[model samples]
Target: MSLRLRLNLLVAALNLGFLGALTWLLIDNHRNSIQEEIEAAHRVTVQMLGSAAQTSPVFGPAPVVMVNFLQSLGRVRANDIRLYTADGVLRYSSPPSAYKAGRTAPDWFGGLMRSTVEATVIGLPGARIEIVPDASRAVLDAWDSMTAIFLLGLGFVAMLHVALLLFLRRLLRPTEADARRLVATTQELAENREVMRLIEAGIEQERKRLARELHDELGQSVTAIRLIATSISRSSEAPGVTQGAGKVNEIAAGLYDSVHRIVRELRPAVLEQPDLAAALADLGREWRIRNPDIDLSMVLEGDLGDLGEELTLAVFRCVQEALTNVLKHAGATRVRLAVAQREDRLEAIIEDDGQGEPNALAGSGHGLVGMRERVATLGGSLETGMRPEGGFRVSIVLPLAGDSQ
Candidate 1:
């Protein structure tokens, strides 16, 4: 069964059971109380008659007194009572009579009145004869009234239970709807996360391709130009000729170095290695050599091991971008790059003691945008701001495999 239907039926059944039990108890109690009251009245009448028989003189001798007492007992307690003579003649009543004097009592009442009571008799050896009439119809009437009330109460209880079940079912509808909406939203977010990962992966591939073209094709051309200059120097022995060769060789060497540097910046060779810290350290060393006037420090605060390929690439790129920005914009003398596993998360911070402004390096270049996108894709966060001192700082945090959303 559906949950709502099952719950409704269960509630209804419990209520019905309780109502039935309560009704039975009430009806039984009412019937028993009325019967007890009637019995008590009959006992009082019997006792009063017996006492008058002992005291009254109009009753005459013992036999007459006994008969008078019996007659008076019949008169006082005969609400629907029946009587019979020694020869089984009908006698008296206390209410609307259903019997007449000429008629003998019915076969059932006559048989019951003729029966013997076996109580211990003080003078007689044999059991004494006694009479017992059927219970009063008034008792039957009271029982019927109680039964009617019980049935009515049962009907009311059933209706109330049904109403309660329906109301509870209606209340659950909104809660069920909210759960469904939450599930849908979570699924949508998961699907979007996958799409973003694919897009970022495509961008990485493109960057690698461009870097290869610059290194292989442009670097080769520069190498050929340098070799040609060396060959001219070897063959031309004249003073002016040698001077021209030396100058051409110097220019060619400079051009080759510059082209190689551009290629490396586009996509560093260290990224191809499996180790992330090594790649970052290589970038740091290169930056230090290129900017001899400024000081740079790189600290690996934890054991940098195999954090998956995508995450490693993203973190490396972020550090590369941050340092590049500092060198290009921040006129500070020192820069520090700190990478560590802080608590459960991997964190990287690039801080420089340079002229700092949060909006200073909001360049139109793809570098900063790519950095934000990469970190976001990993369920991470990146923030760039001015340090308390006169410097710039970039902080990035990415969760571990079990920790990431």
Candidate 2:
């Protein structure tokens, strides 16, 4: 729900709660007033009846006159006027005796008037005038007050709510506009991310093509040149001629080595294999041979080969770049590379005990950006930071479905 709607509802709820409490208090006060009215009426009636009875000159105990007086009292007071025996048996009543035990109000209303005036049970418990608290009128009066209060409160809240809505609608327009701007920015960022992914994939494919070209064309030519150098060295026995052939042989060998290194730099042949684990092992072995003075360790915990070609390639290249950075920049001697399959994801961690400052010298051109881009294209994450202990660490995570997607 919007803030305006929530606030409006809250206001309405609070109004209802407050009005309900006020209505309850009003009803309670009305009940007390009715009780007091009944008690005062009962006291006055009992005193008047006692005095009239004491002063009456009863012409041989005139019962008919007493009945007429009681009937007149009922007519004037709108109360139950009755004459009962000393044993609590009803003897006479006004407007007939049918209404003696009848209710004068609704059951809910009568329930509110729990206390009644007993009139002192004059003579005996039976021959007494009981003034029952007929709360029918009071209940109706309370009902009217409650209705009025509720309607007034609702009207007041409604008016206030309308005014607030009008004010808030104008006030929040800027916030809505800001929200729209934020949404637009988010969409632009997503489009840019997708564009970068395509660019990275293109770059990778280009590298593969270049590696293939150098391997097939330049590689063959160099092999031919090495063969010629071999033949010349064998045919020449003179020291000068032999020395020259040996130099040519040496130069050819060095050139071949450089070509091979360039090919690997472009694309490692091991990445094309189906078994990614074996590729990683081969990668670590090659690095160890290249950096004989550095200690390298690689561990594969589970069956990660099914991670597919693209994801496997990303992982391989990431590690390759990390090792290359370590070899070139880090003056440390030990490196650790670990790849593992856990649940639905594959993770790789590379750490080396070397001074790493790729981020600081990022403008100078570094492999970390390419590594990060490659990982990001797969909808994965790449983190490169210096470890607290004293070296650089790179953490990578790629979903198994990253390649398929």
Candidate 3:
């Protein structure tokens, strides 16, 4: 459900609960009041009639005097009086109450509010006086009062609910200005991402160009120099000349090796083939060779070779930058790199086994930031932190399905 609907439902539920509780409390109070009122009225009526029954024999025959007395007495408030002869003949009956005379409470409501006062009977020489409790009027009054209160409460709750819903709707509704600003911000973010993608693509193109120039121009020149030095060393008869030629040839070979290494770094062969596993393997081998003090371990899983060029390059560069940071900041002895392609996503983790700095990523260096940008461009995320086991860790995840090139 929508948040607005859920909130509205919550408010409605609270209102209903409050109404239910109030109703229950009122019912309990009214029930008690009716019971007490009816009981007190019945008690008084019984006592009054019982006293009159004892004195009736002094006036005349018990039945005749009581009948005359009841006819004069008229309808009692909450009792029905009747005089019956000893032969079971009904001599006199109390008149129906004129107060709410024709009306009665419903059976269910009357049952709920009715009191349990018993009928009173007085015996005399020839007749009996029966005073039965009558609570219909009292019960009807309670029902009327409760119904009025309930209706009032219901109307108030409905108005409150409507008012609250209106207030919430206004509070949650977004303004036109806010909507415009949100749209503008979203467009700006999209443009920024596009700009970053273009920048990265341009950088890669330049690197390729530089690698080609070094390989084609500088590489040939260095080869020519080495060939000339080798020729001079073989042809010269002077011992000094041979020694100088040999030295020149040795330096040229070293220079050539350095140039090739730089070209490889600029435009790795793995990028052309887009094999991340092979690229990482070559990188680890070279890293171990150069930084022999720090042992580098690499683990590749799944089909790393088929990750598109953009994703492969992004992962490789992130891992490369992370290792460089480890070497520069962490005084580590061992580094572990793991890359796995699991279904629709690629994950890479790089960790070092040296004293870790918790705030390494927050330092005044752009390495981590650059790596993050690179990964983000490929619809990926980068996380860097100090490992719990006394090292720094860098983790990256990239989505393979439907990712932008």
- Listed in order, each prediction's TM-score against the native is 0.54, 0.71, 0.88
Across 59-171, the per-residue lDDT of candidate 1 in tens digits comes to: 46543445545555454432333333345444433334353333443444333323122211111011111333333443444445655787787788878887887798677
Clashing pairs in 3: none
Can you tell me which runs of candidate 3 are displaced by over 4 Å? 1-6, 32-60, 68-74, 87-90, 95-112, 116-118
Order of the predicted models by lDDT, top scorer first:
3, 2, 1
The TM-score that candidate 3 achieves is 0.88
Better of 1 and 3 by TM-score: 3
lDDT tens digits, residues 1-405, model 3? Answer: 998999889989999999999988987898898789878988887888888889999999888888988899899888888888999999999999999879998999888877888888989889988988888988888888888999999999999999999999989999999999999997887788889988988999999999999999999999999999999989999999999999999999999999999999999877689999999989988888899988888889999888778888888888888898888988999999999989988999999988887886678899999898988877788898888878989999888894543
lDDT of 2 by residue, 313-389 (tens): 88888888888788877898899999999887889999988886556325465588888877877878888888888
Off by over 4 Å in 1: 1-184, 359-366, 402-405
lDDT of 2: 0.72
lDDT score of residue 120 within candidate 1: 17
**Best candidate (score: TM-score):** 3
**Every model's Cα RMSD, please?**
12.3, 5.5, 3.0
What is model 2's C-alpha RMSD? Answer: 5.5
Ranking by TM-score: 3, 2, 1
The per-prediction tally of clashing pairs is 0, 0, 0
